[model samples]
Target: MIKLLTSADAMLYREIRLEALAAHPEAYSSTLAREQGKPLAWFEERLTTSDVFGAYCAQELVGVAGFRRVDGAKTEHKAVLWGIYVRPQARKSGTGRRLADAVAAHAATRVEQLQLAVVSENEAALRLYAAVGFVEYGREVKALKQDGRYYDEILMALHFGGQGS
Candidate 1:
């Protein structure tokens, strides 16, 4: 089920986050071991955030996606999607789509646009974003640094002007 994540779900968040980091180091900025050192309070705070959303299956946390609400008095109408990850076994199912849909729906309530940065090399994620109506606006070179290497990212955005159906 897709629902807002609570502080009580911090352990599950940590578990799935580490799994994502370990399984796909090239997909994220933080390493598995690096995130493992984070204190429980960190996850607790994250789960309690107003912008965070998560998906659970059979009582097990399988996916998570969230964003920081845009700041500034005028820019509060936008949010950038981040920390999106789903278990390998859960891909290709409706979980990813559901999570994306939930995020978009949630964003629409507070923002006029939903934005996310996807690594150019992550074709699966690129396709998923496109399938959900996130058109590519442009590319940012060397958008992330990992292991002393640079990774380019595609900047995609989905405008909420009668797009959601």
Candidate 2:
């Protein structure tokens, strides 16, 4: 099941977020160390400010994804897909796709386009986004560096035609 997370889920959110940053350090822009040191209130504040969703299994939060609109008049029609992650046990269970779709569907209701960046070599994630109608429009060279190693990211977006086809 998938549902928008609330401030009450902050602890669960922090736990999973730290897991994401640690398991795949190159996949997210935020460092594990950075988030790990943050207080629960920070995560609670994030829930109040962002559109974050969580996937559950047997009432346990197994995955999470977020949608945040760019702050500016010119960028009001766009939102970014961020903090997409699923536990190892949750992999291959269609949890990621479900979470991504939930965020995109909810975002489409308000934005003209939903954008995301994924590390180029993450084939499963690439395929999952493509399946949801997000097409790559650009790629950044060595966009992210971790432990002195660089990783490229493919920039993708799904356009909502009624507003900006």
Candidate 3:
């Protein structure tokens, strides 16, 4: 099952978020050390600010995806799909695709485009985003650096083509 998350789900969200940042450090720009020090209230505020979706299995939150609209006037028509992750045990269960679709569908209601950046070497993530209609428009070479190494990122976006105002 999938549902929009709220401040009430802060604790669970924090746990999963920390897991994602730690286990897949290469996939995210944030460091586990940075978020680990944040208070629970921060997570609560995040839930209230960003549209976060959770996928559950028997009441356990196994996956999460976040959406945030751009703030500038020129960028107001765009929203970003961020912080997407599914637990290892939940892999191959269609949870990631479900979360992606949910985010895409929700974004379509409020923005003309939904954008995301994925590490270029992550084939699974590339395929997942492609399956959901996100087309790559560019690639930033060495976009991210960690521990003296760099990784490229693919810039992708799904355009709603006036379906969203």
Q: For this target, which candidate reaches the highest lDDT against the unseen true structure?
A: 3
Off by over 4 Å in 1: 162-165
- Candidate 1 residue pairs in backbone clash: none
- By descending lDDT, how would the candidates be arranged? 3, 2, 1
In model 2, which range of ten residues has the least summed lDDT? 156-165
Model 1 C-alpha lDDT per residue in residues 1-165, reported as the tens digit of each score: 998888887888888888888887777767887789999988898777756677887887789888678888977766888889988777888888888899998887878888888899999899889988898989999988877889998999988864352
Could you give candidate 2's per-residue lDDT for residues 6-64 as a string of tens digits?
A: 99999999999998999999999999888899999999999999989999999999999
Task: Give the TM-scores of the predictions, in the order they appear.
Answer: 0.90, 0.98, 0.97
List, residue by residue over 1-165, the lDDT tens digit for candidate 3. 999999999999999999999999988989899999999999999999999999999999999999999999989999999999999999998999999999999998999999999999999999999999999999999998878889999999999977442
Worst 10 residues of 1 by lDDT: 156-165
Ranked candidates, highest TM-score first: 2, 3, 1
lDDT of each prediction vs. the true structure?
Answer: 0.84, 0.95, 0.96
